[model samples]
Target: MGRMGLFRDAPQGVAAVASSILACIVLGTLLERFGPGNVHSGLPTFGAIWVVTAAASCAPWNYALTRFFICRTGATFVTLDANQFTCSLMVVLNVIGTATAEATEWGNLGHGVTQILSILVLSEITIHSGMAADTAWRVSLIVPAVFCLVTATGLKLLRRNTSTAARLDVSVTGKITKSLLWDSFEVLKDFRVVVRIMLYSTSIRTELAMNNQLTTRFRTYFLMDAADVSVLAGSFGLLNLVPYLCVHYVDVLCPGHLG
Candidate 1:
C-alpha cells in the first residue's frame, strides 16, 4: 500500500493491517480454544488459521500490487483482459491434464499434473525426482515467494521512472462512513451497475454452490469414485474456456462497444 499509494495517508494502511491481524488472532484463538477435537488435531486446523493470518499479513502488499497494475494499465479493461486470459488459460490446461489422467487412470499422478498446470508449481516434478512430500511442499512455496520478491523489486524499479498521481485514498473508516454507505446505496441506484452486479453475483454463487455439491451428487447418482468425480469437475473448467475466449475476443474486436 505504501509502495502503490493505496492510502493517501500511509499510516492508515498500516493501521488497517494491524487491525486485521488483531481480528484474525482473536478469531483463531477462539477457534483453537472451543473448536472440536478433530480441529485441534491436524495440519489443516493450524494451516487454515495460518492462511487467514497470512492473508491479513500480506493484505497491504497485495493491494499495492493490484494498485500498481491498475495504474500501469490506465484502463480497467486491459487489467481485466489480462487477468481473465491467464485464469482461463490455466483452467483450460489443468482441465486438459485432468482429462488425460482420467483416460489413463493415473490416480494421484493426474491430480499432480492438473495442480502443476493450475499453479505453475513444479512440485510434482520434484516429487517424481525423489524429493520427499514435505520437502517438496516447502520448496514449492519458496518458488512463489521468490517470484513475488523479484516482481516487487521490478515494479519498484519501473515506478522510479514513471510520474503518476496517487489515486483517491480510502481508509477503512472512510469507506464505512455513514455518508459513504449512503453514497454506495445511491450509486447502486444506477440500474446498469445494479443489474450487472446482481446477475454476476447470482451466476457465480449458483456455480460455486453446484461445484461444492457436485462430488456428492456424482457419487450418489453416478456411482463415481473420487477420481472420476475429479474428471467430471475438470470438464466444467474445460467448458468455461469457450466463453472466456469469446469474452476476450469480443473485447479485442469490439473495443469499447460493451463498455
Candidate 2:
C-alpha cells in the first residue's frame, strides 16, 4: 500500500490490535495475580484452569464476531465470491497480509509501546502508591479496561465518519452449514497445515506457560521484588520495538515484498 492507503487503513488495524493487547494483559495479569499458589515446581493447577476457562469463553465470542461482524464489514467494502457466505481463515489472513500489511505493522509497533507503558503503570501502582500488592494489582487492571472503552468509542466514531460509497450493504444472512465445518477441517488434511498447526499451538502454549511463571521465576530465582520485575518486563517491551523499527526499514528498501 502507498502512504495514503496505509494512513487510511491504520486506525482500524491499530484499534483491533490495541483491544487485543489490553485483553491479553488483563487476563494474563489476573491469572498471575489471583490464581492459586503453586503446589509443585510448575504451573499451578488453578492457573491452568483459569487459562483454559478464559480460552473457552473467548472462543465462541471470537467465532461469532469474526463470522458475523468483521466479515460482514469486510464484505461491505470489498467484493467476495457469491458462494462464500463468510470469510474463511485464509481470506482473513490474506486481507491482513495485503490490504492492511503496513497498518498491522504499525499496530504491532503500538503494541510494544503500550506494553512498556503498562509495565510502568503497574510499577507505579504497586511500588510507589503505598497500596498492598493485592489492591494495587486490582487497580492496575482498571487501566486496560479504561483504555478498551476509549478504543471502542474511537472505533464507533471512526465508523460513523467512514465513507459508504463502496459499501455493499451486506449482512450475514446464512447459517453455519455442515459443509462449512467440513471445509475448515479439510485444511487439516494437508501435512504441512497439520505440522504448522502443531508448531503454532505448541509455541503459543509454551509462551503462555512461561509468561504465567515469569514473575515467580524472577522472584524465586533472582530474588527480585515486584518493582524489579516490572522494570525488567518494561525493558523487554522496549527491546520489542527494535524489530518493528527494522521492519519499517526493510519495507522501505523492498516495498511490496514485506507481506
Candidate 3:
C-alpha cells in the first residue's frame, strides 16, 4: 500500500496512535533482549552489531528525514518554505540527543524513542522495508560526507516544487556563499538569543554526558543478567512515558511526559 502523503492533514489520532504503538515496541525490545543482545559469539554478534549500528545510525537518519519532510518542507511546503522542519527536527534531536549519548545514565533514551519512530516510518516510506536497512546502512556510513549532497539535492528539488512553502521570505538577489562554517555569534541577532542558544546547547550536552549510561554501564557494573537488565531498562522506559499516555488530560497538559 502507498504511504500517507506528507502534507495531508493526518488526524491528531494518527500521530498519537502511531506514537503509542512505537512505545510498546521499544520497551518490548528492552524487555525481550534484556542487556543489548549477546555479541560474544559469531553470527549473533554480527546481527547484534548490525542492530547496534542500526540503533546508532538509523535514528539520526530518521530524524533528519522527518525534519526535512515535516518541519523543513513544512509538511509539503511545495510552494512555501520547502524547509521540511519535520526532517530537520529528527536530525537535530537524533544528533544532539541519540548517536553520541557517550556522556549519560539514561543516555539517549528520550531522543532514541523519537528517532526510532521517525526513521522506521521514513524507511518504510521512501525505501521498501527489506531494502530500507541495507540502503540505510550504506547511507549511514560517512553521514557527514553525503550530508551536503543530500541537503543540496533537497534544496534544489524543493526550489522546483511548486507546492513548497518557502520559509526564508527574504529574496536572495545577491550571490550565494558556498562556505558552511559561519560564526554563530556573528549570525545571532542579539546577545540574549546567543546566550539562550549557548545555554540550551550546554544543558543538552550536560544531560547527555551525565545521565546517559543506563544500558552499557548498568550492564557492566551490576553484572545483571541480560533479562534483568532488559527488564530494568524496559521498566524505566515504561514508567517514564507509558502511564501518562494512558491518561487524557494529564498528557495534553504535559506533552513532554508522553515523549
Candidate 4:
C-alpha cells in the first residue's frame, strides 16, 4: 500500500501498529528460545544489546526526519496530532504492560517487551513508511541493511513516489558569509529567548534524567521488586496521558492556537 494508506491522517499509525505486532511476535519467539529462564538455556544478551543499540542510534534522527518531512510540507497540525497520539498510545500501553506484568510471571520483562516493540515499530515507520526520497539516505541504507539482510528484497517495498523533499526549499536563499555567526550571536543576546531556552532545557533534562533515578529509587527505597516498580512507573505513564489528552483537546477546541 501507499504511504498515505499506511500512515493515515496524522502519522504512520497503522504501519506503527502493524510493525509493533510483528516485532512483538519476533521478540517473543527469540525470548522463548534464548531468554533467561525460558525454554532454551541461552541468555538473550546479544538480542538485548542489538535492540538497545538500534533504538538509541535511530531514535533522535527518526524524530528529526519525520519532523523535517511534516514541517517541509507545512503539516504543522499533523505534527502536533501525531505527537499527542503517540504519547497517548505510550501512556496506555505502559499501563496495560505494567498491569499485565504485575499479574503474570513477566514482571519487568513485560514492560521491556512492549518498549522494544514500540521501538521497532518506530524504526519501521521511520525507514519504510516515510516518503522515500525525503528520508535521510544514511537511515535508508542502514535500516534495510540491518533488518532486510535475510530478505534482501525489503528495500524494494519502501515507497518511492512520495517524497516531501520536492516541496521543501532545500536551496540556500541567503548569501553565506562569516556574519552568520554574528547573526546567531545577536539572536542569542535576547534576554527573553535566553531565559526561555534555559527553562525549557532544564525541564527537559530533569524529565529525562528522572526516569532512571525514579525506577532505581522505587526498587531501593520502597523495597519494590521489578513488578512493583513497573506498576508504579506505569501509573505515572497513565497520568501523563491526561496532559496529552488536554493538549489534543486544546488543538481541537482552539484550532490554530495550541497546535
Candidate 5:
C-alpha cells in the first residue's frame, strides 16, 4: 500500500490487534479465575486462548488487509517472487525504499524487542509488585493493548479530516472465489517451497516448546524462586534486546545496506 493508504488503514489494523490481545487476556483471566485446575495449567490456557484468537480474528484481519488493501495498492509492492531469498530481502527493503533481503531480520528484531520488554515488565510486576506470575503476565499484556488502542485512536483522529479520495477503500471489485485456497495449495507443487515451509514450521514449534518450558527449566536447574526466575528471564531478555537495538539502529541509519 502507498504510505497514505497504509496510514488510513492503520487504525483498523491496530484496533484489530488490540481487540485480539484484549480478548485473549480477558479469556485467560476468566479461565484462571473460574476454571478448576493447577495454577501451572494457566500457561496452557493462555496459549490456547492465543491460538484461538489468532486464528479467529488476527489471521483474517491480516489477510484482508494484505489482499484487499495492500494488493490493491500495487502488485510491485507485493513481495511474491519465486526466489525465497530475494522475496525475503525485498520484504524488508521495500519498507524503506525499493530494493530487496533484510526484512526478515528486521521483523525478528522487532519481535525480540517486544518480547524482551514484555518479559522485563512481567518480571518487575512479579518481583516488586508481589503479584502472582499468572496475574503479573496478564497485567503485562495490558501494556500492548493500551498502546494499540492509543495508536488506533491517534490514527482515527488524524484521518478525521481526510478527504474521501484519500481514505482507505476496502471494497473488492468482484465476488471472491474459492480459488484462493486452490492457488495457495499450488505452492506445494514446488519441493523447495514445501521444504522451506516444513523447516519454518519446525522452528516455530521448537520455539513455542522452549518458551512453554522456560520458567520450569529455570526453576528446576537453578533452584530459583518465582522472583529469581523472573529476574533471570528479564536479564536474558535485556541481553537479547541490546543486540537487537544496535542492529535496528544500524538499519535505520543506513537503510538497505543490511539487505
Candidate 6:
C-alpha cells in the first residue's frame, strides 16, 4: 500500500491492523446482536444448519478469497501491504463467526459438529412452494447464511491471490515491534503506500457490511419463512464447494497461488 510512504515503520501499520481487528470483532459482535433481523440471523445458531455451512465458507475467505474481491472491485490492494492487511481483519472476524456457528448451537456442551453442506436450505427451497410460514422463515434464515458465508470466503481468496500478483512497489522490510508497545501496531513511512492503502480501504467496509445483511434482511423482512431460509442456505453451501475444486487446480497455472 502507498500508505507506508516507503513502508514507513511497520509500527504504525501493525498498530493499525491490531486496532482494526479489535474494532471489527467488537463491532461485528455488536452488529451481530443488536443490528436487526431474527434471533438466529442476528446471532449464531449453533444448532442451525445454516450457521454451520456458513462456517465452512470461512476457510476460503479468511485464507485467500480476500484478494480476489479487492482486485475485482478495483481495490487492488497489494498482498502483505501493511496498511491494507489491517482490513483483512474484517474478513477474519467474519470467518470467526462463521466458524463458530456450530459452537453456538451445540445444545448444551457448547460444541457441535458442522456438516459439509447444510441440509436446512435445500429443505426450505423444497417447501417454498408448498409449506409456507414457519418453513419459509426457516429457509430465509439458513439459506442466506449459506450464501453469505460462501460469498465472503469466495471473495476473500479471489482477492488475496490477485493482490499477491499485483505486489505493490514497497517492500515489507521493516521490523515488527518486538518488546512492549502492543501487538496491533505497525508503521508505514511511505507516502505512495499510504495513498494506495487508503484507496482500497475506502471501498471494502461498506461493501462487506451491505452484503452481510442483505440475505437475512431480504428474507426475514420480505420473502419466505424460516424453513425456506434454511433450504436456501444449504444450497449455497452445496454450491460453494465447486469453487474449492478450482483451488486445487489453481496452482497448476499459478504455482504457489493458493499458498
Tell me, by lDDT, which candidate is best: 5
- lDDT of candidate 5 over 129-191, digit per residue (tens): 998754565566566545544543443444221123333121331424332334445657999
Off by over 4 Å in 1: 1-47, 50-179, 255-259
Better of 2 and 3 by lDDT: 2
* Residues 88-198, model 1: lDDT tens digits: 222344243333333223222322344334233443545477876434434555444444345444433432211122221223214443222234356667899678668
What lDDT does the true structure give each of the candidates?
0.37, 0.38, 0.33, 0.35, 0.40, 0.33
Candidate 5's C-alpha runs over 4 A off are 1-101, 127-134, 148-179, 202-205, 225-259
TM-score of each: 0.35, 0.43, 0.29, 0.33, 0.40, 0.27
Looking at candidate 3, the ten consecutive residues that score lowest on lDDT are: 73-82
lDDT for 23 in candidate 2 is 36
**Best candidate (score: TM-score):** 2
Q: Distance from true position, residue 44, model 6, in Å?
A: 14
In the range 131-155, model 2's lDDT, one tens digit per residue, is 8754554467566545544544443
Tell me the spans in candidate 3 whose CA falls farther than 4 Å from its real position. 1-180, 210-212, 231-259
Worst 10 residues of 5 by lDDT: 73-82
Backbone atom clashes (below 3 Å) for every candidate: 0, 0, 46, 1, 2, 85
**Residue 194 in candidate 2, Cα distance off native in Å:** 2.3
Query: Sort by TM-score, best first: what order?
Result: 2, 5, 1, 4, 3, 6
Q: Tens digits of per-residue lDDT for model 6 on 118-202?
A: 3344444555667553344334455544554554454344433223332211223243423223322332466775675575366
> lDDT tens digits, residues 1-259, model 3?
0022222233422433344333322322231222111101111222233333333333433433332222221111111111112222223442322212221223224434433343344444446645454455444433422332454445444432112332221123142543222322244777786685586347533433222234434556788654455545544443424332334235344555666
Q: What are the C-alpha RMSDs, in order, of all predicted structures?
A: 17.8, 16.5, 19.5, 20.4, 16.6, 18.4
Candidate 4 stretches with Cα past 4 Å from truth are: 1-163, 166-168, 172-187, 190-192, 245-259
CA lDDT, candidate 2, residue 182: 40
